[model samples]
Target: MTDKTKPEVEPYDGGEPTELVTIDIEEGTGEAATAGATVDVHYLGVDFESGEEFDSSWSRGQSVNFPLKQLIAGWQEGIPGMKVGGRRQLIVPPALAYGPAGSGHRLSGRTLIFVIDLMGVS
Candidate 1:
């Protein structure tokens, strides 16, 4: 959310990311993923463009797994196609993150950034 007059950054300001700048994933596209879809991802989430680091699985030395529908819109759309042991990134936009509601906390109304690594897909 910059002045709009400034160059279009990935995440933008007000969207003050930790790193402060910019930055997707694999396989199944349209269809929904199943519960057994055992997904292994190393992610780095932030406010976008600012390339900050709100969350990173790698930093914690781990990955996450869950049903497709349970994830965010961006994740539901982004975390597909990844075969078991595959890895990728997810450059999520604001609309896809918290939508209009926003997270209310530190998330507020900011665009989110995520580096999703598709480690494994069941």
Candidate 2:
């Protein structure tokens, strides 16, 4: 695996809930990702407000595989159209993320920011 540098992302300030936002840092080559495609990505996940990193595949030195449909609404919606080798920053509203129910202790009722590297698709 090739070592990828971590991409920078803007943190979400405290605010009203809104839509998912995606910023393309690097445009990738080949077909755009779509629903039902399995994607392999390296991602750094951070708290939207605090900018504290909570998870990262890049830190792990490997990518993770996931079926698009099974991911969170934010990922399911934002990850599509990203080509292989692309880099994107996603600001996910709480509604599109863990939602009201929230996830684990750290992410309860919190919005999320992710810098994602699209490594492969199948």
Candidate 3:
């Protein structure tokens, strides 16, 4: 398994993100993602303020798979509104992310931003 922080981000030097934000970069024509659905996605994670890339599925050469219900709170909330083939940018607040405790050294007390491409759902 990959390290949790590998796909999240390094702890922000700044304070937490003030709110949750989602931007649809591309709208898809396929099924709308729903909770509990197994989804495949390609994502790039970065620091919202700095635009410093933290991780990318493209760099890894493969998409990742998981159930929407099992993802981080921000993803669980943001992704449900997306459809297969859609791409979205998510700006996650700390309360909806790793929170004050954080995920590990990289994501300690950090908010996060993710650009995700929905590939499939089952």
Q: Which stretches of model 1 miss by more than 4 angstroms?
A: 1-36, 101-105
User: What are the lDDT figures for the candidates, one per model?
Assistant: 0.52, 0.84, 0.76
| Model 1: per-residue Cα lDDT at residue 51 | 57
Model 1 has an lDDT value of 0.52
lDDT of 1 by residue, 66-119 (tens): 667777776776665444433345555556666554456566556676665555
TM-score versus the correct structure, for each prediction: 0.61, 0.87, 0.79
Model 1: weakest 10-residue lDDT segment is 1-10
1-122 in candidate 2: lDDT tens per residue?
54568766665554734788888988989678898899999999988777788999878878999999999899999999999888898888878888764366457678788899898889
Give me the displacement of residue 47 in model 2, in angstroms. 0.6
Candidate closer to the true structure by lDDT (higher is better), 2 or 3: 2
- Estimate the overall C-alpha local distance difference test score of candidate 2: 0.84
Backbone clashes for every candidate come to 21, 0, 0
lDDT leader: 2
Decoy 1 TM-score against native: 0.61
What is the per-residue lDDT of model 3 for residues 18-112, given as tens digits with 9 covering 90 to 100? 77777787788789888788889889888666668877987898889998888788999899869887878788976777766545646656667
Better of 1 and 2 by lDDT: 2
Candidate 3: residue 119 Cα off by (Å):
0.4
